[model samples]
Structures are given as structure tokens and as C-alpha cells.
Target chain A: MTLRRRFVLVHILPIVLIGLVLFAPKARPGLRPCGALLAAAGVIELLFLAALARRKRAVEPATAPCDTVTLVWALLTGWELATSVLHLAHPVLVPAPENVFDTFREQPLVLLRNIASSLELLAIGFSIGLALAVLLGLFAGWIPRLRAFAYPIANVMAPIPAVVISPYLVSLMPSFRSASALVIVLGVFWPTFLGTINRVTSIEPQILDSARMLQPDNRTMIFSILLPYVLPGVISGLKVSMTTSLLMLNFAELMGATSGMGYYVQNSITYANYAHAVAGIIVIGVVVTVLNALITKFQKFAIRWH
Target chain B: MNRIECAHVTYSYEAHSRRETVLHDLSFTAADGEFLCIVGQSGCGKTTLLRLLAGLAFPNGGAVRVGGAPVTGPGTDRAIVFQNYTLFPWMSARKNVMFGIAQARKGLSKAETAALADEYLEKVDMLRAADKYPYQLSGGMRQRVALARSLAMDTGILLLDEPFGALDARIRGELQRLLETLCTGEKQKKTVIFVTHDIHEAVFLADRVLYMADGRIVRELPVDLPRPRADLCCADADRLCAARRELLGWFDRTETEVQV
Candidate 1:
């Protein structure tokens, strides 16, 4: 199809979705209105289309983004039809899109505050975990005596899943918040520690040879040569480490804590407010996507080498 | 006194439960301020000898010495360039050179280190690409940066193990001339040991060329050509041509023997 035609397809599909949500007659009794959800979806799609239009001249192969948006809109229309118009599904189990998204229009501050709290914990835990791993890994990797001592210990500890033992830790620790943070730390530390050691040991032979020829002192070798050499590997592994830590954090929060995204979801489930729980799940997805994008941008700036 | 020495040096590699000797009783020396190139076929232990000189590897059976002292380990007295990965991939060209200068001359201010780095980069015509990381550069450009780094160090001994082995012919020739000027132009000449398989390159760069075969230096040829001899200018010279032919003859004979 022609370029204009493809864009028209993207522009037209969302309108069908909006029309269904705004005007579809409800067969289900006492279903919530679609105003908040429709408004939110409209604004987001508008921003995305604006970006697409602005970059039209240099738009990517013209299939992936446009088709994806069309597909999303088509799915939204199907969901609206199935829930509010036909009422074919179980009314309580499968909530109307209107009620789920209304949770956003109603109590955004509670969600935001919970997100902020979770992020703070993640940051504290992740930073401490990564810093300790890299520092200890460097010393251990460079000195054979330390390597011998630390390797066995790391091997044993690195295998245990923080999530599996997190419930016990939650009860054992004085506070739930501390237990949650500890879970994130334990989740991030081991893989990064082992990864750092592997990177140091497996540095390119020629690069190692050149560094040796320079005759770096012990401190310089660790901080200067070995650190930068392993930094790219560490940064590249950040996504996996971050994802793992976030899993541990949410799992711990789901089990015990009171105010994180995971808690928001679990509490909503306890109160039979599945709509709010679904909204909380959506928030968690958005946060993870944004964090991953930020990490990718940071990786580009940090690692200038191959 | 000899600037570098290797006496009865032997190196072995144990792999897959087999002990393989790489260099067997190798012995050679480069005189102070002389450029010595060891030309050999692959697997001839030429690079192992260079590493021994650089103190990157210890001789299993014999001693390797530099400046009349038995080499203990890597020291600030030597700088080296390898076939690949001489510059750290994470560092820019200027930083790599600066890092080398820092390791060799400890007390230089950061500004002084940077200035020295730029000077060496300029010598290799890589000043424009000083900020580029090694991955951004072509193989030849990377080699120029590597050369700049080792030269910037200004150590007493310089070791190069097939430093230009991966470059195209034209770039290789340009670097060859650049290397010649950099080594000889300095008032305090560094004792250079360049290992290569290229006979013409050895003839072009070295004051003396050592030919190695199967882990031993079998012949030494002295090039009597004039200093800073133009490329192809010394090609027609009788002595250089004879040395080139003799080196070529050795490699050809070895290839035939291996095939047989």
C-alpha cells in the first residue's frame, strides 16, 4: 500500500476503537462509564501519532510501529465489545476497560507515591549491590589468594534464589522495608559479582599483554586497566540485573510489604477490586519499560567501545 | 651493552594434556639504539621471543635480560605494541597514549601527559582522530594509535609483535615509513625489536634482521643501506636486494619442506 494509505490505516483504526468505547450501548447492568479510559487512550495515541507524523519523512520501514498501533487499537475495541456491549464473559472476573482505567483518573497520587517508594528502595539496593560486587570482584579477581578464597563462597551463595528464601528473611528481619531492600540487594549482587570476575579473567589476551608491558602497580592495575576493561560488560548486564532485582523487590512486596506497586496490586485483590489491581499491573509495566529505555540510553553514553 | 638479551630462552604451552614447546633455546640481542626485526614464518616462536623481551612471559628454561640485568617482571623501562588490541577498546586514542605515558613517566602532570600524547598522535597523523575509541577506527588507524602510545611512553626498550600485520598494503607502507622516522628521528633512539613475517618490511625497518625457523634464530642479516632510505630507493641497492632474496629464500624453502 501507499505511504499515505498506511498512515490512514493507523489513523482510522484508533477512531474505530474510540467510537466503540464512547458510543457502544451497554447490555451489562451498572458497568462504569468509559470517559476516563477513553480520554487517557486518546491522549497517548495522539502523542504517539504526533511523533510519527513529525518523523514521517524518515519513518522506519512503515510497518512495525503503524501495524502495532493498529493491532493495539483493534484489541482494545474487541475488549470493549466483549465486556460492556455483549456481556458474554463473567462480569466480575473480567472487568470492563472503563472501570480498570478509571482507577487512573480517580487515585493517581496513591499510585505515584507507591511507585516513588518502590523506586527509592530499588535505587538504594541496586547501587549498593553493584558497587560492592565490582569492588570486591576486582580485588578478588586480581589477587590469586583472594580469588581462591572468594570463588568457592561466591559459587555457593550465587546459586540460591533470593525470592525462595525471602519470606523467611521478611519475618527474620526487624522491618518489612529492610527485608524488601535486602531481597533486591541479594538478587542483584551475585550475578554481577560472578560476571565481573569472569570479565576480568577473560580480558582479551593482547590487551592484557599490553597492560602488563606498561607495568601497572597493583592498585593501578585494578582501578585503571581492569575496571574500565570490565565496565562495558557490567553495564551491558545491567538490564538483566535490574529486571531480576525488580522481580525480587515486587515478589517480596507482594508477600509482605504495604506500599509498593506489588502491594497496591495485592491489596486491591484482597479487597475484591480487580480493576485497581489491573491498573497497578499496568503501572508496573510502564515503569519497567521506562527504566529499560533509560538504561539503554545510559549504556550508549557510557560504553563508547565495541 | 646490549639493550635487550634472550639467552637459551625456552617456552612451552600445555594444552589438551599435551606439552608443546613454542620457543626452544632461543638466544638473541638488540644493541643499544638499534632497530632489530625478527622475520619468520608463523609458529616460528618470534612473538614468544618478543614477549619474553617485554617481560610479559618468563622463559621456562633460560633467562631473558634487559640492560645487563636479568629481567624479573614487567617494568616501566619497556613499551610494546601487539598485532591487535594494543590500545584499550574503552579508551580513546589520546587517552590510550596518555595512559602509556603515565605508566612510563610517573611524575608528568596531566597536561604534560596529554601534550605528549597529542605530539605522538601527530607523528602518526592520527591527531584528528585523537578522541575516537579503538572500535571507531580502522585497523590501520588503530595501529597508528597503538604505535603512538608505545612511542609516547619513551621507554628504553620498544617491542612490536607484528604490529602492522592486519593492515592493508598501502596503509602498512605509510605506517612503515612513519615508524622509521619516529624511531630514527628521535635523538635518544629506543632499542626496538619488531617481529614480522614480511621480509620487505624487515629490510625496510631494521638495522639487522634475524630470521627464525621452528623456534630458533637460524640466520642474522645486516642491512648496509643508508639511513632514512626512501621506499623502493633502497630496493635496487645490491645489499638490500641480496638480504631480501636470502630471507625470501629461507621462507620459500621452509614452505616447500612443510608441504613435502
Candidate 2:
């Protein structure tokens, strides 16, 4: 399919599923109006398709990686018609897209405070964990004695899922945030650690021989040779690590948290304000997408060798 | 007196997880400023012996020394140009040459490093590709860059492991001439160890030819032919061709023995 068609299909398919689900519940009175919501969603999505059609001549190949503006528009347009325009489904359950956008304006201070707190925790935890992992991984890879000690420990440690211990960690720690950050750290560290060790061990033997010929000491080996050698792999590793850290953070927040995007969802769910809950979900998706894009940009700049 | 000495040196590697000796008790000396070509049939450890001199590999027994100093590892005093993939693909030609200069001339200024690299690249007729990566160049061009990088190191000893072995015959002949002109015409001469499977190549460029069979240096043949040697029309070309024919006879004998 053309990307435009795929683009249109992406928005159209979800409303179709929602329509099918709504009509299936014949006895649910409030959901009868959901058919109208679905119809309006269909219309807005058709408009999106028409807009895409109008610019089809300018469109690049179907496989070209494009900006997310189209995706965001599709998401918001589907959402806007689903709740406010048609008043479909339960009154409390369906939050309007405008209401979600308003959530950002209404509680900007709270949003900023929570986001800042979460980022600070992530920066501290990720830096510490990543630094330690690289150092230890380099040591393990280069020296046989250290490898004997670390390799077994790493094998044992890597499989212990961070989420399983997070709740207990919350109880043990002074603050839930610290525990949550610890969970993120643990979640990111193991894989990166193991990956660095593998990268070091699997480095091109010729290059290793070249460095050995230079007779650089351990400090030079790690700093100049090994670090630069493994940098491309590490940058590639960062995308997955960032994702896992976010997953752990959200999971850790679900159990107990005062502030965060996760806590925002948790609090709204508790108050039975599904609108706020839905808003928080949208926010989390946007934030994660933005962070991932930033990481990709940084990755391109860092590994010009690639 | 930075001459190389190999005293009963041997080398082997594990093949099929079993010990397989490639070179056995090889003994030879390459004096300062001597261009010694090692000619042998394939798999005769000619390349292995060069690796020993370059300190890229350790001898299983005996010793390989340079100017009375034992070679424990590869050093700035000896720069090597292999038949293939010696230049780091990620670096540009200029940067590749600069890397060698940096290793050998540590205290030199940035401008000096750049100028010296350019001078060598110009010598190899590769200054036009100085900013290009290895992959961007043809096989012959890449070898020129490699040669430039090796020469820029200013090493007293140059080890060439069949440096043109991968090229087509025409390019190989051209580069052999380039190699001859570069090493011979210069005021400051270097001790060279050239390994090749081609006897003609050995005779055309070498001051002395060492023939090997079954991992041993069986004969040493000195050319003692005058300089400004040209393959096509030099006065001593007939003498070089005759020497090449003699080396080719040894290769034919080795082939017949293998067949039997």
C-alpha cells in the first residue's frame, strides 16, 4: 500500500474496531451514540486522507522515514471525534481530545515538576549505572582474572528481572522515587554491561593486535582504544536501554509514586477520572517518542564512522 | 647497524586444532639498507618469516633480532605493508599516513605531521586521494596509500608481505617499479624484507633473493646488479631475467615433489 493509504488505514482501522465493539453491545444505552462518534472519526480520517491525497505528488517513497506530525495529527483527530463531538459511550469514560490538550495547560506547573523530577532521576541513575557497566565490562573483557570473577556474576545477575525486586526495594528505600530510579538503573545496566563485554571481546582481532603493538597500558587501552572501538555498539545499545529504563520507571511508579507520568495515570485512575487517565497516557506516549527521536539524532552525530 | 637477524627461528599454528609447523629453524641476516626478497612456492612460510621480522608473531624457537635487540613486539622502527587491508578503512589517506607519523614522530607539531604525510603521499603519486577513504579508492590506489603510510613512519626496516599480491599483473608491475624508484632513489636507504610468490618480482626489485621450500630458506642468490633497474630495457635486465628463471626452476621442482 502507498504510505498515504497506510497512513489512512492506521487511523481508519482503530475507529472501525471501536465501532464493531460499540455495536456489539446492544444493551449498553450510552454506547449507541458511539456509532455516531465512529462515523465522525471516519469523516475526520477521510479528511486526513484527502489532505494526504492532495500532496501525494510531493510524497517520497512508501518506505521513507517521515516526521511524526502525520501520526500525531491522526492520533489527535481520532481522539477529538471520539469523545467531545459525538458524546459517544459513557460520559465519564470518554475524554475529549481538547480536554487532554487542556490538561497540559491546566496543570503545566505540576507537569513540569513531575517531568523534571523523573528526568533528574534518570540522568543520575543512568550515568552512574552506564559508567560502572562500561568500566567493569572493559575490565572483564580485557583481563582473564577479572573476566573469571565478573563473567559468572554477570550471567547470574542479568536474568533477575528488575520489576520483580522493585516493590521490595521501595519498602527498603527512603523514597519511592529513589527506588524507582534504582529499578531503572538496574533495568538498563545489565544488558549494557553484557553488551559492552561482548563488544570488547568480539572486537576485530587485527585492531586489537594493532593496539597491542603500541604497548599502551591499561588506562590507554580502556580510554583510547576500547572505548572508541565500542562506542558505535554502545550508541546502538542506548536506544534499547532507554526504552527499558522507561518501562522500568513506569512499572516502578505503578506500585507507588507521588509524581510522574505514571503516577498521573495512577492518581486519575484512583479518582475514577478516566479523562485525566487517558490524558496521562497520551502525554507519556508523546514524551517517550520525543526522547527516542532525540536519542536517534544524538546517535547519528556520535557515530559518524557508521 | 640496524640489521635484522633470524637465528633458527621457527613458527607454527594450530590447524584443525592440531599443531602444524609452517616454518622450521629458519636462519638469515638482512644487513642495514639491504633489500632482501624472499621468493617461495605458496605455503612455504615466506610470509611467516616476514611476520617474525616485523614482530607481528613470536617464533616458536630461537630468536629474531634487529640491531642486536630482540624483537618482543611490533615497534616504530619497523613498519609493515601487507598485501591487503593494511590501511584502516575508517580513516582517510591523509589521516592514515598521519597516524603512522604520529607513532614515529611523537613530538612533531601538527603542521609538520601534515606536511610529512603529504610529502610521502606525493611520492607514491597518491596526494590527489589524500582526503579519500580506503574504500573510495581502487585496489592499486589503496596500496599506494598503504605504502605512503608505511614510508611516512620513517622506519629503518620495512616489511612488505606480498604487497602487490592482490593486484592485477599490470598494476603489480607498475607498483613494483614505483617501489624500486622510491626505495633506491632516496638518499636515506632502509633495510627491506619483501616476500612474494612470484620469482620475477623477486628478481626485478631485490638486491638479493632468498628462496624457500618446506618452511626453510634453501638458497640465497645475490643480484649485485646496478641501480636504475628497469624491467623492460635496462642493461642488466637480461641478468635479472636469468636469475628469475633459476628461481622459477626451484618452484617447478617443489611443484613436482608435491605432485609425487
Candidate 3:
């Protein structure tokens, strides 16, 4: 289906389900199943959907984030009405979406501090890892003997998952932040290094032939030709590395004495505050989205040829 | 002091699956300002001969001497134009010509180099597309740019290996006429070694035609044609027809089912 059609369908399906549950003739007080609040919810849901459909054509098909975002918002609103306003859900265990929002407001300082800590580690670790990967990858790819020696080692090490060794890594390092950053670095380094090698190897033959005819030395081959050829590929590989780096960072934060988004969620679940835990999950989603968007913009500016 | 002497040169290559011998005891000399065309069947070392002349490769035995000095490699003294892939795609036509100028005369400023490139592009009737890349140009236009680049170098010897072989017949005729005009217009003319399998093309253009078979020159037909030579309406047309017939007969004797 076209992106526009799919976008409309995503918003429409939830509205139809909510309408069926709350807009029937007997959805009123006493004699009705719930009250006028449930009927009012159906009207609010329909208005939210109409507003969404108005903006659907402006949305690009491949960017389905709006659809996902709208669905998440609508599902939470429905959950709120079912549990708190209508009293239709189980009493003690099921809290409304209002409780989730209240949980967010109650510990805003704690949440902000943890987010800052995680972001600090993420920025430092990813920068070091990506910079080292590019420099070493370019070196290994350009020279034959270096490539032959480094490629087999990278092949063996790249396939091992970075998350599996988090517990042991956490014990070995002096501080939790150091261990977490190291895990993220290891997580992001290998694929980018390997990708750079493949990209350098498959560069266009005509460009290489022209450089060879010019009889450029080894320094020129690496600086002038190989770097430009691999820049586009490296920028593209950043999107993948960004996600994998976050995965390692969060996993490492989950284990030990730490102040991070992962630790916040882990600590909240420990105290049986599921509402705070859910809010933490939402914060992580927002943080990752913003980080990826920044990388994407950087990539666009770096590569104009493609 | 004004000649390229190939003193009994020989070269061979190893195919991936077998050994192939291309040239054996090949000896020829091209004098100053002489246009020589080497015509032969495919795989008869015609291009290998031009490469040797251009100093792109070395002979397995014997040497190539330019002005009584042995050639080492591709120097500014000689410029080469292949059948195709001569221009770098990333560079525009003017830039390609300017690169030759920079290689030939390094001390010139960028503006001086650009002016020289523009002058040659105008001479070859390619100034309109001087800023266009190779991929953006037609095959004939790219060849014209290649010609302008080679000519702008103003090398002592111009080595063209089937320069117009990839062009269509109509464009080929136009470039041949352009080559003639360029060759005769200069006061101190340049020597040209053109390699082709077309008999009429050789007879129409060259001062001397060297026909080869089995990796050796078998016949030398001196055209002695006049200058300002147009492709049509010339006495050289009749001479070209006669030389074409003679070369075809030689070709048939060597291999009866011959097709280029």
C-alpha cells in the first residue's frame, strides 16, 4: 500500500475499536454500562482522528514515526478512560495513563539527571569508537599487508555479541561508567571497521586507474582517494552503529551502581513502581529518536554526491 | 635528433590460460613531422607497437629511442590517446585538458592553464561542452576532448591507438578531417603514430602506411597525398581505394575468413 493509505489506516483502526466500545446506544449512566464520560471519550477520539487525517497528505510515506506516535498517544488515552474515569478495568492493579503522567512529574529531577548521565557516556564513548574505527579502518583497507593481518582478527571478534559479556565487564572495570562506555565502544567499533574495509575494496576502478596513472605515492592513495571513497559509506554506517552503541550502553547500565536511563527503569521495577518503569521506557524512545535524527542530518551534510 | 628509432624491439604477454607472442624482432623508425599509420588484423601487436612508442611499457628485448635517447616511461615529451577511457570521468573536458597542460608545463598559473585549455577546445570545436563531464558528453564529443587534451600538450609525438575506432562512421569522418586540419596548421608540425585496422582510414590520413601480419610489418604503402585533404573529392581517394584493395589481398592471404 502507499504510505499515505497506510498512515490513514493506522490512525483509523484504533478509532473504530474505541468507537465500538464507547459509542453504542447503551453507553450511559446507571442503565447504561459505564457513563457519559465513555461516550464523551468516543467523541474526543473521533476529533483526534479527524485532525490526524487532515495532516496525512503532508507526511512522507517512509517516515512512519507520526503514525506510531499517534497510535501510542491514542492507546494511552483509551487505557486512561477504561481504568480511572469509567472504572471498568480491575481496581488495584490497573492504574490509568494519568498515573503514568503523574509519575513522570513526581520524579522529574531524577529522570533528567539519569538521562544526562547516559547521554554523557554515550557521546564520549561513541565519538572515541567511531573516530578510531575510521582511522584504523582506512589504514587497514589502504595497505595490503595491514589488511591481511587485521581482517582475520576482526572477522573472529566482530561476530561476538557485546551484551553477553556485560556482567563480567562490569566486575572488571574500576567504575561502572568506564565499563559501560567500554562496552559501547566495543559494540560500535567492529562493524564500522569491517564496513570501511569492504567499501574501500569496492571503490570504482576508473577513479583508482586515474590515480595510479598519476603515480601518486602511498600517502596520496590513503589521504586523497581512499578517504573520499569511504566517507559516504562511513556516514551511512553511523545509523547502524548509533543503535548498537545505545544497546550496549543501556545493557551495561542495567547491572551496577549507576545513574542512567537503564538504571532508572531497573530501579523503578525493583520497587514495584510499574508506572515509573513505563515512563522510563518512553523517555528512552524519545532520546534514541533525537540522537538518530542528529546523525541523519550530519550524514546528509557529509555526503552530497549520493 | 628528430626521430623515434625502435632498434629491433620485441614483446610478448602471458594470457591467463596460455602464452601469447605479440611482436618479434619489430624494427621501424618514424622521422620528424611524419604521420605513420600501423594497420593490421586484431591481436597483431598494433596497439603494443604504439604503447612501446609512447613509453607506456618496455620491450622484452631491444630498446625504443626518441631523439637518440632511450625512453623510460610516460613523459611530457610524448602524449597518448587510447581508443576510449582516455579522459577521467570526474573531471570536465576543460579540466582534463588543463591537467595535460599542468603535466607538460607545470609553472603556469591556473588562469594561464585554463586559457590554453579553452584555446585547444575551440580548435577541436568542443569549447561549447568544455565544462561537461565525460558521462554527460557523447562518445564523439569525448574523443574530441581527448584530442584537444593531447594536442594542448603539444608533445613531440602523438600516439593514437584507434582513436576513432569507437566513433560512428559519420563522426569518424568528421574527426579524421579535424585531425588533418590540426596536423597541417602548425608551423612546426608534430609526428603522429595512428594505429587502426581500417585500410581506407590509414591511406586517407597517413604519410606512410605500415601493414603487418604475424606480428611483423609486411608492406609499406606511401600515400604522398596533398594537404588540406577533405574526405571527399580528392585524387587521394583513388589511391586510398587501391591501397585498400592491396591490404585486403594481403589480409586474405593470411586469413581467408577475415572480418573486423
Candidate 4:
């Protein structure tokens, strides 16, 4: 078969098999929701396939996305068969895909509220942590005495996981939100600070010479020459830093928070609402993926010279 | 006057509890508007001497003086183009040139500095790639931008440390001609101190050439070749050829000394 024919076969076989299972005679009453959910999913996949075929010329043939789409279809088909048709596993522990997906339609407002709360905390904590790190890192890196004093301290403190101190921070701070933000700041600050110091110290000697020949003052030297020289390294490290900070924030939220994506998941598991918990996990994945994409875009725009 | 005087300057690099002297009591002077080249084998301290002249480093003993003033540190009075990585990779060609102009001629508006950058970049035939970053450009193009930046600074003293040394032969010749024209073509010629290992380059571009070896000046030869000395078809071809041959002999003698 041609490559295009193979793509169509791979995509269509899974959809047809899934459709047969969805419209088959009902083996149990709760299976109705699963069938409805699978039917809707099949329609969505058809739409997606149409779109993909339209844009297929833009993408290289036989790349990751093609295989990825096929894999996703296979996963969904297997999941539907196990939960609805065979009833092979523990029912409550592995909730049917329909019920898991239906949590979105059933509790849209609740999910949105939790997501908004989580993102708000992430924005505040990330901004404060990154700004302080860059500012202090630049100063500590540039000055000899400051670097000598802080470098050893950062080496000692940065290795200690921020999550380890969250319980104490919660008790010490006036509010849980403040405690969470503090945890994230501490998590992000040390690594970024250390990286900045190393980068500033290791700037290419000839570049330093070129900047020095311009006869700039201390302020100009730190802000203009040193900052830009070290920016590509800093921006490259941002994705990792962002991921760690989010992890820290979520861990803090799990301790005793009233609302957040992490709190939502923890709360659901407490009440044995597996469907809602699964939905929450998927939401977190989507949020992180979107955030990573945004960071990649910002990196490209900021360091076009690189 | 734009004369530069190095009064018995001494320099050394201290690495891991050991001091290795690079320039030992070196002394030289270049009159105003002189195009001087310092040529020697690698590690013979030609670059160290240029760095001292550019005020990028300090002498352990004595001083480097420009126009009767002792050099303390790098100043806007002198602009240097290093062999490689001199252009800030973070900035575009135009921005790099503007940076130099802004430093040397303070109080100019943004428009004025930008215009000055354009003029110099145009002179070096790099105006078409003004917005290109150093990494995006070829080695020869980057050196052209570096030359543009130094010239745009409009300083009395220009210090070049093998500015064209990393380029291919054709591009090196092209830049050599550009440097010669820029140094001698202007009415108020700038004093230039160029350092290179290429003897032919020294003979072609220098009004006077200093041959350095083992941290000392081995010889100084004055080239009385005619203007626009791009080729050997001139009436002074024999003189130019004789000067080149004499420099080559010094290199051969140094190689024999090392072998012995």
C-alpha cells in the first residue's frame, strides 16, 4: 500500500472496530454511557483525520504525529474493550472511559474554578521566583565578594528539596497560599542563581574584552553586556526551571489546600470519585503541555540571535 | 598628535603558582598616522604587545602612553578588532557598530549614532547584512562588521589583532585591501597597530613592520612601497620583493634556532 493508503487504513480500522463495540448489543446497563462516549469520540477522530489529511502536505510523511495518532486510537479502543465489553478489571478502580470523560460535561464549572486557582498561584509564584533569581543572581555573580559568599551557601541549600520544608512553611506562614508561593520561590531561586553565576563567570573572554573596550560603567556593564551575554543560557534553562516550580507548587497545594488542580485530585480520591480524579490528572497534563509550548515560543522570539 | 609610545613595558601571565613572562621590557613608538604591523611566530608575544597597546591589559613594569597620556585602562580613544569572537554575538552588525560609536562620541542622539553606523558599514560593503548577527554571518563578513565598528568609533588609534587571520585566502586578501585603503585613503589618517603572523600581509599593508620573537623585537623594516600596493606590478616591485625576502630570511633563522 502507498503511505497515504496505510495512514487511512491505520486510522479507519480502529474507528470501525470501536464503532462496532459501541453500537453492539448492551451486555450491562452502565455500558450505555460508554457506548455514547465512544460514538462521540469516533466522530471527533473522523474530524481530526479529515483535518490531518488536508494539512498532510505541510507535514512530512511517516513522522511522529502519524504514529502518535495511530497509537492514541489503539489505546482508546483497548480501553473501551476492557472496561465496557469484557468487564475484565475492578469496576470502581478502573472507571469506564465514558464516565471519566463525562466528568468534563458534568462538572465544567468546578473544573474551571480549580484550574483558574491553580494557574493563578503558578503565575504569582513563578513571576516572583524568576524575577528575584535573575536580579540577585546577576548581582551575586558580578561582585567577587558576593559570589564568594553566596556560591557556597547556594550549593548547600539548592540540593535540599523544597517539598521537604513545605510542612514547616505551612505552619510558619500566615496563610496556605503564601506558604505555597514561598515554596515555589525557594525551589526556583537556587538553581537559577547558581546557573547564572557559572554562566557569567564563563562568558567568552574575547566578548568581555570587546565590551570592556567600550568603557562602560558598572551599571551598564552588568545590565547591558553581562545580562545579554548570559541570556541564551538562562532562557534555555527556563523550561526545566518552570517544570520544577510547577511540581513544587502542586506538591505544596496537596498538603491542605482548599482549591487547586492538585487539591481537586486529592479531594476526589478522598471521596472515592475515581472519574473526577482521572479527569483532574488529564487536565494537569494539558496545562503543563500548553505551558511548555508557550515557553518554547517565547525562547525562540527572545533569542533569535542564538 | 596620535603617536603611541611603549616605554619598556613588561607583562606576564600567572597560572597555577607560576609566572610566565610574555613581553620583557619591550619598547617601541609609532608616529601619528603610521600603519605599523607586528609579525612573529605563534606565542612570540605579538598579540600580547597589541593587547598592551590597546589598553586591554596592564604592563607589570613601565607604561603604554598615547599622545603623552599614560594608559590606565581601556578607553574610547582606542578601538580594537580581535581575530575572532570580537563582535558581540547577541547583537546585529548594525547594533555592534552603533555600540562603538555611542561609546566614543557620547551625547549623540540615537539617530545620529545609527547614521554613523550605516556610513561605516557601507564603507566596508556590509550594509546589506547590517541586521545579521555575528553567528549568522561568514567569517569574512563578521570581520568586515568588526572593521566597520572600529572605524565608526573614529578613534585616533586602531588596534587589530590578526583581524583577518581566520578567514580564507581570498577573503583575507579582500579584507587586507579594505584595511589598507581605510588606513591610508582618508585625509586625517588614523594611527593603526596591526598584529599578524603573515609576513606578506605585513609587507603589503605596513608603513613600517616590527618582527618579534621570544618576547623581544628582532627587527624593524620600513616599506617604501607605492600607494595602492595591491600587486607587484609597480615600479617599486624590486624593493617590495627585497623587503619580503628579508622578512622571510628572519623567519627561517628563527626556525633553525628552534630546531637546534
TM-scores for all candidates: the values are 0.95, 0.82, 0.70, 0.95
lDDT of 2 at A195: 85
Q: What Cα-based lDDT does every candidate model obtain? A: 0.86, 0.78, 0.78, 0.86
What C-alpha root-mean-square deviation, in Å, does candidate 1 show against the real structure?
2.0
List, residue by residue over A1-306, the lDDT tens digit for candidate 2.
766676665555455445444543333222223443444445555755555455656555433223343464556555545555455546667765445455665676887777776677777778877888888888888888988888888888888998899889989899997888788778877877888888899987656655554445688678767887778888888878887787778777787788887787888899987766876786677678778989999998876645
lDDT of 3 at A76: 56
User: Which ten contiguous residues of candidate 1 chain A have the minimum total lDDT?
Assistant: A51-60
Top DockQ model: 4
Compared with the true structure, what per-residue lDDT tens digits does model 2 show for residues B160-249? Answer: 888899999999988999888878666868899999988888898888999999999999899878776763565477877788788888
TM-score of chain B of each: 0.94, 0.95, 0.93, 0.96
Order the numbered candidates by lDDT, best leading: 1, 4, 2, 3
For all candidates, state DockQ relative to the true structure. 0.84, 0.38, 0.19, 0.84
Backbone clashes, each candidate: 0, 0, 0, 0
lDDT digits (tens) for residues B58-147 of candidate 4: 899988999999988899999999999889888899999998888889999999999999999999999999999988999999999999
Instruction: List residue ranges in candidate 1 displaced over 4 A.
Output: A50-59, B231-236
Q: How accurately is candidate 3 docked according to DockQ?
A: 0.19
**Ten contiguous residues minimizing lDDT sum, candidate 2 chain B:** B227-236
Better of 3 and 4 by lDDT: 4
Arrange candidates by TM-score, descending.
1, 4, 2, 3
Q: Candidate 1 at residue B93, lDDT? A: 94
